[model samples]
Target: MAEYTTSKPEWAPEKDDENKFACGVMSGIDGITDTTVGNLNPALKNGTMKPKRKMVLSVDDYIKGVSSGDRVTLARAITLIESNNPKHFRKAQQVLQGLLPKTGKALRIGITGVPGAGKSTTIEAFGNMLCDMGHRVAVLAVDPTSSVTRGSILGDKTRMGTLSRREEAFIRPSPAGGTLGGVARKSRETMLLCEAAGYDIILVETVGVGQSETTVRSMVDFFMLIVLTGAGDELQGIKKGIMELADAIVVNKADGDNLLKAKVARAEYERMIEFIRPATEGWRTHAYLASAYKKTGLKELWDVIRAFEKVTHESGVFKRRRDSQLLDWVHSMIDEHLHNLFFDDPVVLGRMPEIREAVLKGVISPTQAVAELIHIFDVQRATQRHVDLFHPENQK
Candidate 1:
C-alpha cells in the first residue's frame, strides 16, 4: 500500500464552493424570475403558486368581439353588462357606447304565454320558417330559476332541439335569476349583440309565468301572446294589462282534434281583444290559430309580423318606439342601480339588526326605524365625501 494516506482531495473546497455558488445563482434567479417571466406566481419563491388575477377585458376588445360577430364574446359582454361591479358596469357602458350605432336595426319580437301553451314549439317553427326565408334568426329563451337552488333549468335548448342545430339560428337560454321580468338582467344587451351579429329577426321568449308579460312587452316592437284552446276562459281570466299589451294573440295547437276548439278560442279572443285598447295606432290587434308542431299557419303569422313592421317602419313609429325604449331602459337601469347601492351601504346593513330588534321590542316603529337608518346612511355618505375631498394623500 503505497503510503495509503487519508488526505482530503485538494479540489474538495473548490468543488464545494462551486456547488454552493451554483445553488446561490439558482436562488437569485428565482427571486427575480417572476418579474422577467411575466404573470408568474409571486408565491413560487415562497413555495406556493399565487392566485391568478381576474382578466379585466377592455372595452376595445369587447367592441371588437361584437363587430367581429364572435358569439362567445357576445355572451361575455352580456355578462359584463349584467354585473353589479362598478368596474364592469363602466366597461359595459363603454362597449355600449361603441355599439350604439350598430343596434336598433333588427326587428325585436317578444313572444310569451302561460306554461303548456306550446310557446317553445311555436318559436321553433317560427325560427325555422324565418331561416328558410334566408333570414338569420336569434331566439333568446328566459327560464325561471328553481327557488331552492336559484339555478334555472335552462332547458330551452332541449325544447328547441330543431332550431338549436341550425347553422343560421342562434338559441340562447338565460336564467331569469329571479328577475321580476320574464327576461334576464342583460337580455337587452344580448339583443343588441344579436343585432350586431347580423340577425335580422330576434325573438325574445319570456317565462310563461304570466307575470312577466308587461316586462317583455315593453322591450319588443311586436308582442304575441300564445294561448291554449281548452282553457275555456278565453280572455276573462287573462289579465287585462297583458291583453292590452298584445299586438297579436295566437292560439296554438290548432291541428288534429283541437282545430275547432282553437277557432272558437280565437274568435273569443278576437272579440275580447276588440274591447281592449289597441297596441298601436292604425294597427288592429288580431288573433289567429296555428299548429306549431305541424308548421301550419306560420306563414300567416310571419305575414302579420311583416305587415306590422312595414307599417311601423314607414310611419317612423318603429324608430321612435326603439328610441323611447332605449331611454326607458337607461332610466330603469339607473333606478335599479341606485336602489341596490342605497340598500348595500354598510351603515344601512349594519343598522338592520338593531332596527329589527327595536321594532320587535316596540321601542321604535318600523317607519321610524327606516327613517333613522336612512339618516345614518346619509351621515356616513356625507362623512365619506368630506374625507375624500379633504384628504390630500388619498387624492394622490
Candidate 2:
C-alpha cells in the first residue's frame, strides 16, 4: 500500500527531486497524466504491474529494504546483483557504494572441501551455533553452473534445510557461471549488503574443486576447509593449494565408526599445516574433528572463529586485507569490462558471421580469422581518425 517514487532510467537523471515521478500501479512509466492515466482501467493497472520488466529496483531501494528486514526485497536485490546486464552492473555498484561503510564488521569466512565432505551440513551446524549465541548469519553457497544449460543446481537450500529456515539466517546459492572464481560475479557486493543488513557472520561456501579453493581464499578473512574421513587417498589427493589456504581444517563426519579415521585425518592435516607457512600474521592454522550430522564439535569451531576474529580485528590486519581485496576486485572488474566492451562492439559483432563462414569453408584458419578481425578493427580505427581530422570540430 506504500507509494514509492521512481527515479529516471539508469541512463538519465532529473534536475531535482521535485521532478522525480511515481511508478504507476499498472505501467512502470512515470509520465502518464490524469487524462490518459485515468482512462486506463484500474483493473488493467492492477493486473499489469510487472515489477520485473518496467523498473528494476535501484541499489538505494535494495539497501533500504534489506536494512528494514524485507526478505522479498533482499532476494530481488541479490537477483539484480547477479545480473550480467550492463545497466544492472552499474546499478549494483551504486548499491555497493551505499553499503560498503556499514560492512567490514562481520566475520567473512570462506569454507570449501571436496564433494560429499558434508559442507552444507557443517555450515548448518556452524550457523545454528552462531544464531544460538545471538549472532545473525548469512551464507553464500556457490554452485557450479551447468555448462550445457548455463543454469545452476541451487541445491544449497535443500541441503541446509534447517538453517535455511532459521529466522536469523539467510542462505543464498549462487551459480559460478564457469568463471573458476568459485563465486558468482556479484558475491562481493552481496557480502557487503548482507553485512550492512546487520549480519555479524558471513560464510561463503565454494565447491572444493581445484583452482576454486584459491579463489575462495582471496576474498575472506578466514578460510576453513572441510573434509571427510574413510577416503584412503585423502592426504595424497588433497591439493597443496587448498591445504595451504586453510585457516582451519575441519574433518567432518567424525562421529560413529568414522571417529578414528577423522582423528587420523585431523593429525595429518595438523602436520600438513606445519609444513605450509601460516597465511596470516599472529594466526596459527589448526585442524579439528567434527560431526555436523551429530552436531558435535561445532562449538569448538565457533570458538576458533571467534578467536581469529578477535585477533585480526585487534591487529587491524582484517581491514587491510579487505582493502587489498577491494583493489584486486577493481582491477579484475575493469579488465573484464573492457574485454567485454571490445568484443561486444558492433564492428566485432558484424564480422563474426563472416569469420565463421570463412572458417567453415576452409578459406581461413581460426588463428587467421583472429588476425583478420584485428586487422579490420585497426583499419576501422584509422578511418575514424581520418574522418575526425577532416572535421572542423576536431580542431580543438
Candidate 3:
C-alpha cells in the first residue's frame, strides 16, 4: 500500500481552484512527525488501529434506557446531565423533558451534619437496610470542591463500599463547583434521573458545612441534621440555623461510653428545638438517638420518614413543597444564567481588571466597585437591545 496519497475532493470547484482554496485536496499523511510521541501514538504509524468513535445515546434511547433501569445507560445519562458542554446541555434538557413524567416519584431526603459526625457511615447502614427490605435506594453525596485543586476529593463510593456493590443501590458523588448551596447545581436533575431509573428512595448527602446546606433542604421533601454527642456542638448547630432547618436532629454514635452522653446531647437538642420554629408547618422537629455502628434506630428512622411522607401528603404540605421547589429551581437557574452572562460579557471583562485593581488599592470601596460593575453590565446589555441605560430622552 502507498504510505501517502493525495487526491482533490469531488466537491472542489475545479483543478484551478486548488491554488486559491485552502481546503482542496485530502492529503494522506505518511506518518506522524518524528517530533511527535511515536511511543504513545503507535497507531498513527500504521493507521491500522483507528481511535474508536464515542457511542452517543439519542434522546429516545436515554429515555428508554433510564426508564427500563439500565444502570450503565442511567449512569451515562447522568453524566450527560452533569456535563458542562453547551451541546450536551441541550441534549440533556431534551432527555429530561422526555423523562419528566417518570420523575418526582421518589422520596427525596437530604442529610447534613458537622464534620466527623459519621454521616457516611449512617447512610451506608441505612441504605443497606433499605436494600435488604426490597427498596431501591440512590445515595448522592455532594462533595466540596477543593479551593486549590478545584476538584472533588471526597470518594463516596469508597466510603459506601458495601452499598455501592448492591444491585438495588446507586451512589453518585457530585462536586459543588463553588455553588453556594451545599448541593450541586444540577442535583435536582440527578435526583429525577434516579427516580426515573426506579429508585424509590433518594438520599442526598450535602457538603455538610452546616449552614449552606439549607439549599439542600429546599430540594428534599425531608431534611435532617446529624450531630455528634459533645464538643458543645449542639448549641453551635442551633446558632447556625441548621437546627431550625432540620425536620429531625439525630445524635449519632450512641454506643459504648458515648451512649449516655448521646442521650444527654439529645435532651439539649430537644430543649433547643422548643425555642425554634418548626421546619415544616404541620410537623414538629425532634431529636433522636442513633448508633450507626450497631445499626440501631435506623429502622425507626425510616419509619419516621415514612410517617412524615404520609402526614405531609395528607396535609397537602408535600405537594406544596414540591411546587415551591419547582419555582425556586426556576428562579435559581435564572439567577445563575444572568450571573454567567454578566461576568462573561466582553464589556464587563474588559473593565473588571481595572476596577478590581482600584478596589484592591483602596481607591474605591467594595460597594462602589459593585455598583460600577452592575452599571457597566446593565449598560452593555441595554445596548444590545438598541437602548441606553442613561440616555436623557430615554430616561424621561
Candidate 4:
C-alpha cells in the first residue's frame, strides 16, 4: 500500500455543498461563540465540596465562640440578636447574659459626619492604623434605611476595603432600621458582643442623621464628629447641639485645595466648643484637621482620644458614665417592653377598637379613653394573678 501523501486531492466543499457548514478556516479574531469547556475536575464530579452544615449552637457555644474571637460565630451571634423573632431574641438574651462579664473592656468610640464628609474613609485609615498597632478593631457602620422600602444602603464595607480585608479588623454594616440615633436598635448589644469577642477598640459609625449625634453620645465612651471644610459656618451653626455632643471633632479632607479652609474650620470649631460644657468631664473638647486620603492627623486624633480616656478615668467619670449608661439601657428596655405589652395585651386589644371608635365619635375624650384602658389593664393583671395562685395546674 502506498503511503498517504499530497497526491490525495485537497478536500474543499463546493459553494452550495451542505457539508460546507463543517468546513471553514480558523479565524483568530473571531469572537467567542460559546462557553463550552471540557470536563470539570474529577474531585468535583458528584458535586463541588460544600462547607459542612453549621451545627446548631447552644447558649454556651455562642459564648465560647465569641470569647475565642471566631468571626463567623461573632457575625452569627450579632444576627441572632438583630432578629425581631421572639425565639432568636430569647437566645440572644441568654448569650448576652453569659457574656456580660466580658464586656465593657473595650474603648467604645462613635464617629459621625455629614453625608460625603469622608466618614468611611477616615474609619478605614483609623481602623487600619489600630490593626497595625496589634489591636483588634471592630467597626459597626450603621447605614440609613430607605423610608419606603425599609432597605439599607449598606456599602460601608465596600468603602473600607483595606481594613475589611485585615485579619485583626472586623467590619459590620448594619441597617439603621428607623432607629433615631443612626444606631440600630441592637447596636449597643452588638457592641457588647464585640467586646466579649476580645476587640479592644470598637468604632461605631452613625448614619449621619442630625439627631444621631446625641444618641451616639449616650452609647459611646467617646464621640468624634468628622466635618468637612468649605461647607460654610451655616452647617456648623445649625448643628451646635450636635457639636456640643462631641468629645472631639476632626476636619477631614484637609489636603489639596481644602487645607487652608480646614484649618480655619478647625479654629472656628475650637472657639465655638469653648463655651459649651465638655462632653467628657475633666477633658476639654478639641478640633483637629485631617486628610484621610493622605492618612495624616490620625495619630493626633488617637492621642486626643487617649488623653480624654485617661483624664475621665482618673476623674472616676468613666466608671460613673458606664453605670449611668447601664441604668439608661435598663429603663429603655423596660419602656420598650411596656409599649409592646400595651398593644399586645388581650384586654387592651379587646377594648382598643371600641375605645378608638368612641374617641373618634366624640363619645369619649382621648384622655378618658386612655384612663379606661389603664383600668382594664389593671383589672386583667389582678385576674391573672388570682388564676395563677388558684389554678389547679399552676399550683403544682
Candidate 5:
C-alpha cells in the first residue's frame, strides 16, 4: 500500500485468478500452495480415455485377426460361430471358409472324467506346463447346461485362474446346450477356430456326463481319461466303453495320503485296460499316477502324448482319425440340421403340442407321432420348394 504506483501492481489478480487459486491452492495436511494442479486422469482430460466401441467385424477382419493370433478377434470369431442366430451362422461360415487353410495343423486332445475326478485341475496343471514349455494352448471347456434354462454355469475359468491368465493360453467355456456327446454342438468348429488361431494344442474338455467319452474320442487325436484314487472299483462310475475309448488313463491325487491308493488304482486300471483293445492300433492305453497338486507326472504324461503322436502320425492313424472326425462332424451336423428342420417347421410347430398330448394320452404311439410330424414337415418342405421353383424372385 505504501508503494502504490500509477501502473497496476504485480500482485493484482486477473479475471480468472480466483479459479486458478482454487485449483492450485487447495488445503492440505501440510499447507495450501500456489502450485498448478495437474489432472489426475490426463487421458480423460485429453479425451483419450474413451473406450473404443465394439463393432461387428467382417470375414476378412476375422481371418486377419485369427491368422495373426489376436486373442480378442479369435474370441469374437468363436462367439460368432457359437451364436444361434442365422446371420451369425452365415458370417461364421464365411470366416471359417477363409480360415480353413490355416487350420488342421494343431494337435487336438480330448480330456474327460467323471464328476469330482479333478479333471479341470489336472488339465490346468498339464496345460500350464505345456505353456511353460513354449506351446500355445487352447482349452475348450464344455460346461453342462441347466436343463430348464439351457444356459451354461461357467466355472472352469475360475478353477484355472493361473493358466487362464497366461498370454499363450486360451480358455473357452461353452454350454453343452443339451447336445448329447458331452460337448457343445459347436465344439468341433470351435476347435478348428482355435487351430486357425495358431494354437499348437487344443484341449477339448467334456462335461463327463457319461456316453460323451466316445464322442470326444472321435474328435480328438489324443484322448485322456482322468480318474481319482479310492473312487471305488476300477470301473466304478465309468462305463467300460469309456475305458476302451481312453488313449491314456491317468490316476490323479497321487500325492500325500492317497499315494498308495493311486498306485493301486493305476495297477487296477492297467489290468482293466489289458482286457480292452487299444484305442489306436499301435498305442496301448496305460494308466499313470499323477498329482495335480504337486505337478508331478505332468512331464511324463506329455512325453507319452508326444510319443503317441509320433507313433500314430507315422502309422497314418492320426490322419485317418482326423478324416473320420470330419465325416462324423458332417453327419452329426446333418442330423442336427434335419432334426431342427423337422421340429422347426411351422406345420410341425403347430401340431407338436397336440401330438405330444395324444402320445401321452396313449391315443398314438411315439413312433406314430414322429412319423406324422415328419410327414407334415415333408409336405411343408415340398410346398416351399415348389413355390421357390415357380417364383424365383421371391426365394430371397
Candidate 6:
C-alpha cells in the first residue's frame, strides 16, 4: 500500500504544488468482452489527442452574463467585440444592443501622457483607492503593438499587480491593432460592456502616442494629461494642441527630491493654462502635483474629478457632450463601413496597385492618382447599382 501512494503529476510546474490537477488513469483495452474501454483512446497508440473546443456562448448568454456582472461573460463579450469575424460581429452587436440601456451611466475618464510618465502606476494606485472607497473601476489600457512583430505585450494587467487582484477592479489591456495613435478601435465598445457589468467608473489609459489624446478626449467625460517634472524646453512642443484638450494636468512623481520640481512644473502649467481655452464649458483647467508611487495626492485628484462631474452635469454640458459623442460615433461607424466597402471592392483592388505604382514612379501626382482611383471606384459602384436594378432576380 505504501508503494502505491499517490505521486505528484508529471506536468505540475512545481514539485510540491498541491493545486496540480490529478491525471485520471485509463483502463486498458480488454480483448473482446469490453472493446469500448480504451479502444478510442489516442494515448494508447501515442497518437495526437483531439483538442478541446471552447464553449460557444450565444448573444443571449452574453447579455445575461453581462447583466449579472459576471466577469467571465463580460470578458467573453469583449473578446467577441474585438473579433474580426463576421459572425462574431453580428453576435457582438446583438449583445451590445441588448445591453445598451445599462451603459452610459458610468463616469468615463481618459488619461494620457508621454512615455515614462507613470500612467500605469498612477492608474493602479488610483484604482486601488477607488476600490477602497467601494467603487467598481474598469481600466481600459491601450497597449501599443510592436512595429516588427505587430504583437502587443498587453502588460498593463501585470503592471497593476495590486489593482488587478482586487475584486472591485477590472483591468483590460487591449492591443492597438495597428490603429492610429495606438488606441484600440474596439475600446469604446468594451467600455460600454464594462458599464453594463456594473463598473461605475471607466478609466481609459491611452497609448500616449499620436492622436490618442484627441481620440480619448472624444470618448470620455474628463480628460487628464499626466506629465513629469523637468520638462524645460521640451515642453514647448507638447504644450500646445494636447494641452487644450485636458481638463487637468497632473505633474506626477511629486515625492522626495522631486516634490519641489513638481510644484514648479505645476505652477508653470497653470500659467500656461491661462493662455489656453478650457477643455469643457463652464470649467477652469488647472494643474496639480501627485506621486503615484507614494499614493499621495490621488484622493484630491478624485475630488477634483468629482467636482468637475458635478459642475458639468449641473451645467448640462455632460449630457450635451454625451449626445454629441453618440452622434459622432454613428458618423465614424458609417465612415468605417464605407471605407471598408470601398477598399474591399474588386474594381478598386485591381486599380490600386497600378495607381500606387504610378504615384511612386512620378507618372502621376499623388493627388491625381487619388482622383483617378476615386473616379474608378465611383464608376464601379454606379455600374453595379445599375446592373442590380435591372437583374432578372430583381425584375421578378
3 or 5, greater by TM-score: 5
Candidate 1 residues lying further than 4 Å off, grouped into runs, are: 1-58, 379-396
Please provide, for model 4 over 1-396, each residue's C-alpha lDDT reduced to its tens digit, 9 standing for 90 to 100: 122122212466445554545544421222222112112332333356643424357788889999999998898899888877555666777889899999999999999988899999999999999888899999999998999999997999999999999889999998888888788889889999999999999999998877647778878899988888777642564455787778888999999888988888888888788677877778788889998999999999999988888989999999999899889888987777667667767878999999999999999999999999997886456455344433435422
Write one digit per residue (lDDT tens) for candidate 3, span 260-347.
Answer: 9999998898889899999998998888989999999999998899999999999999999999999999999878767777876788
**What are the RMSD figures for all models against the true structure?**
13.9, 11.4, 12.2, 13.6, 14.1, 9.5
lDDT of 6 by residue, 35-86 (tens): 1121334432344665242246667878999999888778878888888755
Error of 5 at 244 (Å): 0.6
lDDT of 2 by residue, 167-264 (tens): 89999888888877567777888887888888889999987775556677778999988877776545643454777777888889999888988898
Per-residue alpha-carbon lDDT of candidate 1 for residues 1-396, written as tens digits (9 for 90 to 100): 111123334544554655344322112232331121223333543447754432345678778877777766676777777675544555667788788888877899999887788888899999988999999898999998888898888888898988888878888888888887668878888898888877889999989676557778768999898888877546443554677778989999999989998898888887787678888767899899889989999999999999999998899988888888889898987787566656767778887888899999999998998788777776456456344323534432
Our model 2 lands, by Cα RMSD against the true structure, at 11.4
Regions of candidate 2 where Cα sits further than 4 Å from its true position = 1-60, 236-240, 352-396
By the TM-score metric, which is better: model 1 or model 6? 6
Clashes of 6: 0
- Residue 17's lDDT in candidate 2: 56
User: Per-residue error at 202 for model 5, in Å?
Assistant: 0.5
Per-residue lDDT of 47-78 in model 5, one digit per residue for the tens?
67863523447778889999999998898888
TM per candidate: 0.79, 0.77, 0.82, 0.81, 0.82, 0.82
Residue 45 in model 1: lDDT:
39
Better of 1 and 2 by lDDT: 1
Go through the candidates in order and give each one's C-alpha lDDT: 0.77, 0.76, 0.83, 0.81, 0.81, 0.82
Residue pair clashes in candidate 3: none
RMSD in angstroms, candidate 3? 12.2
- Candidate 1 has its poorest 10 consecutive residues by lDDT at 25-34
